[model samples]
Target: MRVEQGFQPTPYTEGNPFTTDPVLPNLLKRLLPRDVHEEVYGDLERFGLKVLTTLHDLTSKTSEPRVVQYDQWGRRIDDLQTSEGWRGLKAQMQEEGVIGIPFERKYGEFSRVYGFMKQFIAIGDSDVISCPFAMTDGTSRVLELVGSPAVKRDIFPRLTSRDPSLAFTAGQWMTERPGGSDVSQTETIARPVSNASSPYGPVYRIDGFKWFSSATDSDIAVALARTGPPESGSRGLSLFLIPLRRPLIRPVDAPRPPALTNNIKIHRLKNKFGTKILPTAELSLEGAEGYLLGEVNQGVKFITPVLNITRIHSALTSVGSIRKCLAIATAYSSVRAISGGRQLLKDNVLHVAELARAHLTYRALTHFVFGVVLLLGKTECKVATDDEVLRLRLLTPAVKAFAADKASGVMEECMTMLGGQGYMEESRIGTVLKDAMVEKIWEGTTTVLSLDMVRAAAKPGVLHASASTISNMHQWANTIVSSCPADLVHRLAERLATLRICVTEVISAYTNPSTPLLSRPTLALFAYTTSALYLLEHAIWAHESGEATANTDIEVFRRWIDEGGLLPALQDVRRVKTAGADRTKMDAEIVYGNTSTTQVVDDLPISARL
Candidate 1:
């Protein structure tokens, strides 16, 4: 007797990300001017559909790039071959003005909001094309701020062009064998070429090996090289714009073959664990012609704009990855069955609780990243107040580090929500998990970014200004919570007090160097406190405005304040403070395991020993 086949799970289908997203529409409506929101609303909807359809299809069909080192004739002709689908995505991004919207400034201060909202929707499925777009966006900003007239006139237009054929993506070649994030150890050398003449700037011959060059297929690049004594460190480095390909020299009617600029050689594409579709490579620059970007030995100073912009991009990507994973899990849960097909996954209380908790964190981070994006737009438009600028400075690194640090865990939880299918690459959730993992290490590792946060807060008046902003947010939230349930009101008061105490400790640590503070914990405390306040602010607004999701927003805020989010950071701070003289030894023991002669708790489980 043949038995009927078991049930087949329904296929997961994604909707237009922008339209289907529960939080983004309300966010834009609240943050953007009515006219601006109305103007871009249709475009966002159409682009969202395109992202799931055309963009997704294109990326799904493509494979990672491959390199050919030589021609059949044994001549040294390095050829990089990417799939047609990859090229199609690049063209689509250019046509959509993914990098051009902010440069156009059509919406003024809200342009970045509009631009990055599109980026947030598209990045998850862009097949890592956003990697090139980030560097390209940063390059355009650099050019606008410091490029010479000739350079801006020649290249800036291409960088920000909406026309696919005219657009030029840029590579940021900063990493070398000797230095990764530590630009101080950069060994690439740049020498002035007196005989050469260029309209861009004074030409220089750059010589070095770039160990990791993302967007290797780009038209031009900004590289950092030393011009001063080797020991001068970062102070000796200068920024240069290097044309990646030689200008075509076509005689009267003859066709000349294309070539790499100077002696630039494509060594090989990196076999990375994620973002495989992007062309990251090791490059050899033997006397490559480059143009000076700013004053000599000011590379570190000039590249600050690029670093800031890219860090924001990293934060956006981190949050976007989580959103995509959550979307997948949410969509899949409706159809996936459990308990011998008697119940759907979404109806299961335990499963729904995990998704709800993940959603809470996602909501908080969404506000945190977009808050910085809005500040960036205002600052770029020269309309930001002094306090806003200070807040931006302090929050940029915190957002990047915090969002990246949290995204992986949230994504892993989402993956688990999908059960065994989540572990398969076919689900795309696993792929996103791998890609999101890179954001933590991309712009800067959590440790490095935490230190950067400390440096920013250490600046004169920065900590005070930032704390003032959070305090104001807390005051507003304090008033709003008064109308809520008494328990929520109590929780809000307690959390606000904790926030104040955390801020005091942070200020004391930065102001009085004698106060010991771990950079990672300090950054975490700052990020969580600020994020908690932002979530509360959003909840207040939703409640006051009578938004449809007001109940959910209030609940998220409630959970976040009540031992859901800020507890980890508070606990970390307490652990550090109470450790006192034993902090160093305890940290070492935690990392390396206790190597002392202390009696082993063999009777207890391994987990209890810690």
Candidate 2:
């Protein structure tokens, strides 16, 4: 008898993300001017091929970076060494103008859309290069808004440069030992340097320890330091531009400044759960020289733009990771067989359903992020109306939180579809999953973001403005759904009504101090409703435009509105209203685990409780 080899699954071959993504091309076509769309489409196709080939290979071969704390002679040299692959990726990112596109503003209000679309496609394989690029973009925006003219002339060009040698990436250093997200607890101090100034701003000597600093290898950073009394909280803080290495001396021709001459000491690099290839470190800034970006004691206000931009980047990262994982699972399913090799996994209805569900989620998130991006672009171009500005403020945090919360589950679903192959590092899905998990925590945890959304909603006229926008979306969607089956139209109308009721109830609770507010759930309800509206609007556009994927788009919209758990969430609003005390008691029991004293203490209103 002859021995036969066992079966082997075919290797996964990834398609060009820009061209192969089911939703993006159509989305761009619908949103962009025809000529602009055509131009970007061609460019994206070529870039997409590079992403699948060059970028993919670079990220695959890249090793985690390491910090060499000392040299052979016991010299304290904090040399951050990264792989050749990492360097190549960075070079490509600059050469491709990944961070410069929006700043270049070749397309006016659509520039951000164009830039972010490229970012969304490239992020999956960029080896967390997006991390530094995001900070660079945010830093550039801050300088654009408030930097001294000298700073812009000297530093801004480098930030947006397409020439790899001329380009500069920036880090954001805000977290300290006393605070992660709470800048109020920041302990860094900046003491002014009299009769000293640089092209950047008024010079200061900063002395503090930054507990967590990502993009540690970047050329420069925007850091927050206390310039006021210790008791002043966040209002006492000030923003500064800190060059990571010492600047060259004033002479026209001079040797380079000695390493770490600025007194930035890299205490240690973090061993993180994900984004391993990116360099992150704790730093002691002992008399590190920095330049103030804006007015003193206004760091929080000046840093808002950076936070908003970075949060948007985080949302894109989350959605992009999910898209990449789904792509891998999808390609694998086509080659992998099931039922004793009688059928491919792609042919299995249950597997296909799971894939479809994940795709639906990806599609919804893409729309949400891009919608916010469009608003940002408008704001940047100075074309955003007051209402548009308000809508952007309300939606930014909600969308960021929503996308991040959905990403992990979608990643898990894709991984499961690939079985054991997905669990392996070789698949790259595991790596994406790991890196994507950081999105939730870095920008802000879901709970923190939910509270932010609640705060935004509570702002005068913000809630009403958002409700008005949603109502407008409903009217447009109703017109589109009118021609469909009565039941489908009825369902759409009912959901809209529920959304209105939820918004009304939230406003009522806000107005009436006696009513308990469920901040997290309210965010969920609004985010889900907004996502559904955006998806429906897209479906209508696709159908009206006679796009090839109109039917599929309509199906996605239907499944999202009907089976996406929005109805259950709506129903739960009633239960929450009636069962607040009971729910509170149960929550305390679950957390304290039958400890009566703890439960009683926890159940008390926050004003009366610890």
Regions more than 4 Å wrong, model 2: 1-5, 248-259, 465-517, 594-610
Root-mean-square deviation of candidate 1: 5.2
Error of 1 at 23 (Å): 1.0
Structural similarity to truth (TM-score) of each candidate: 0.91, 0.91
| Candidate 2 lDDT tens digits, 395-459 | 89988898989999999999888898889888888889999999989978988887787677666
Model 1 off-target regions past 4 Å?
Answer: 1-6, 248-259, 465-491, 513-517, 589-610
Give every collision pair in model 2: none
* TM value for model 1: 0.91
lDDT of 1 by residue, 56-124 (tens): 899787788998888899988878888998899999999989899999999988999999999999867
lDDT minimum window of 10 residues, candidate 2: 468-477
